[model samples]
Target: MDLKSYFNQLTTKERELQFGRKAADPLRHAFDVKRVVHAGMNGEMVPPPLAQKTWQDLMHQKVQGHPTQMAYFHIPFCKTKCLYCGFFQNGTDQAAEDAYIKRLIREIEMDAALPRLSGAPIQAVFIGGGTPTSLSPENAGRLLSTIQNCLPLANDYELTLEGRIHDLVPEKMDVWFKNGVNRMSLGVQSFNTEVRRAVGRLDDREEVLRRLQTLSSYNQCSVVIDLMYGLPLQTQEVWQDDVKTLVDSGIDGADLYQLDVFEQSDLHVYIQKGKLPPAATTQEQSAMFSFGKNYLEAQGYKRLSYCHWARNNRERSLYNTQARCGTHLFPFGCGAGGHVDGLSTMLERRLPAYQAAIDQGRKPLMFLMRQSPYAPLAEVIMGQMNQSRLDLQKLIRMEPRLKGLEFLGSLWEEYGLWQDNGYLYQLTEAGQFWQVNMTQTLLESVEHLLGGSSQIHQKKVAAQG
Candidate 1:
């Protein structure tokens, strides 16, 4: 049978099972599920670029009054590429890595002088990458020092350094803490050694736990560890153990992400060639996510956001929260993505292009800038939904096009996906499981209502021109 018909049939069966005599209409649910699945299977959509003049205009307006909340630096070097990653990353070359840091610092200095960014006191700075910790201690220190010298950071600024377990040595952590980094986000996708090996992540489980213990001892910096579900060899027991261990390890926070096997990633190719096991089914993955959410909440960890849990207010994830809320994020380094004044920006993905731009005294290449009229509202909706709650009335007030979207609550309520408490709507357990899909469905519906079409408006940057 064709995919549409298959989904229709599947939805019908699900409705019968889910509600029996009280089964509501399943057509919309089926259509939404199909769209969600299709989107998940597709590759990342690169937004089209806007002209440099447009970017400059937006930056000018942004600087005049817009509050700068976050800044991000991307380090694109990794010790080894994980099987499931599709990020712009290269194998660690010490010389190339050092050179990249130098160029990054130069870019920072250049940005500091820009009239559009002058005197903007940033509340958060996120040093993320293929693996930021892959940088040597000296290079990392230099990068941090450059940021401190160039940018005006808020007094209570949040500085986060993203890394892997093996790279976060005690000495390196001390370096980070001393340099104003108050948070460390480690990618410990799984504590299962077998699962880690299968996905090209080489870390000893005992050593990882030991490092977490040591990291927890550093009261100056909060620790947030990432755990992944739906890996090839991940079992429910193993996934539960990962969550339990994280809670008991005294880490400040944990972020649970589902394994997303990109089509271009090694894991996808391995599965296609029958060289690796298939990922868990959607049902299995949903169960795993639900388990993690319930277990974490039960452990006194507050679900600050959909995927993020924190033991206290110190681990507020300021950068992520601000970025999601459509606050300005200044981008630095190759392959970093940010948004400012309604224009989504991305830096050059290639190291040579990024470095050459800096050498010529220009901002790194901006390959994409999404300046759609509907983008702001869309971002707000997506961001709020990602947080597992949405104030329908508030959204309608923000964008009148959302006036009739209240029916979405009814549909969601019928399917047990959301709770409508008459004042605001929040995602129920089922809705959180299908959050991404539901968010997409809502965005598409809003687009249709606004008579907006998803068209890429491409323009060449002045540097490229």
Candidate 2:
């Protein structure tokens, strides 16, 4: 169907959501608000009654082809919980970690024996969680050895260990380097000592810089830090210094993140009680995003993704890049989630339950979901949008039905979101700020055009800032 024919089938409300309002500055005030922080399409939540047979028929005994693949190992224990965190599972205890690692290794061995993952070559391995860096040297060694031994790691695999600054000592760093951890992603939300303490970060500014420099002195791994823009005490000037610090720190790459405040959390309570300052409003965050993007580009740092930047070749960030574009990931450890063999699975979260499943010699499956029928196309769109450009020709080649989406390109251009540079639609500064909103609208438009679901109409609400 053509764009006009498709629009003719929808009501005004539906059109407004599917295509955004025609605003002068479509950057900050286009959408009512940003709905989801990490934006992407999802598949079926529950298996349809008839899908069981279809799943069985389509399921393969082995990985289908040489698709890029990765593995995610979750460490669910933290030495201390951050004030703003919602993912904290358990406090650190040596006895608890020892037991968990033993079971985790067992679970790894069991999955390695499965037909789907047995011989597949995983190109990237990410050990992430409450703090993978906080693991004792002994435990870290054992876990790393098991992963290197059991998994079919490719010759040039990138193994990233995520953690905090307090754990960046020589003791942990030595074991990490010895065991093939070539990438270290540390969270340094802000370098201001006052700001760090307000958010429950233990290290002071001096220690953070000293530890980062020490880690880089090893010269054996690529180091990256994460900086958040909308923290409770992170002012505009502070945000500038944080990014400045990232560039000056000589790290390989950085992630410029916007904070999401969850209601009913410790952070929220403290703010309500006047104990902490208010977080940056969404409008302010949009400006912060623009400044970060421009400053990094001016400094000659390459844009690896919408939120990620790289200063050199050492930091390709393979796992995150491939995972976003729909690479298969083998999941392990408590609370880990990954997708493989046409299904996504989340392992059990509770320690006792995870241990029991591992002991039973079965896959510790907490939830399993079949992907959406349009998953392949959705992956391409999301992956491209994240890099601030979309190829319309590729989209048309992927699915002729997507030809109707160019109506959106024409509309967004008028609103100052993107430009048509030959065959590619490149997003401008405004488009990058509102990329999530534009991405979702395009995905929803595609789904509606293809008759995937019924649309709900809303009375068009005028948005102005």
Tens digits of per-residue lDDT, candidate 2, 295-407, equal 89999998888888999999998887787787888888999998875677788899999999788775677777877777788788889998899998898898988888888
TM-score leader:
2
- The prediction achieving the highest lDDT against the true structure is 2
The residue pairs in collision within model 2 are none
Encode model 1's per-residue lDDT on 129-184: one tens digit a residue. 88998888899899998888888889899999999988868778777777888999
RMSD of 2: 3.5
Off by over 4 Å in 1: 1-50, 56-62, 66-68, 452-465
Model 1 RMSD vs true structure: 6.8
Error of 2 at 391 (Å): 1.1
Q: Which lDDT values do the candidates have, in the order given?
A: 0.74, 0.82
> What TM-score does prediction 2 earn?
0.92
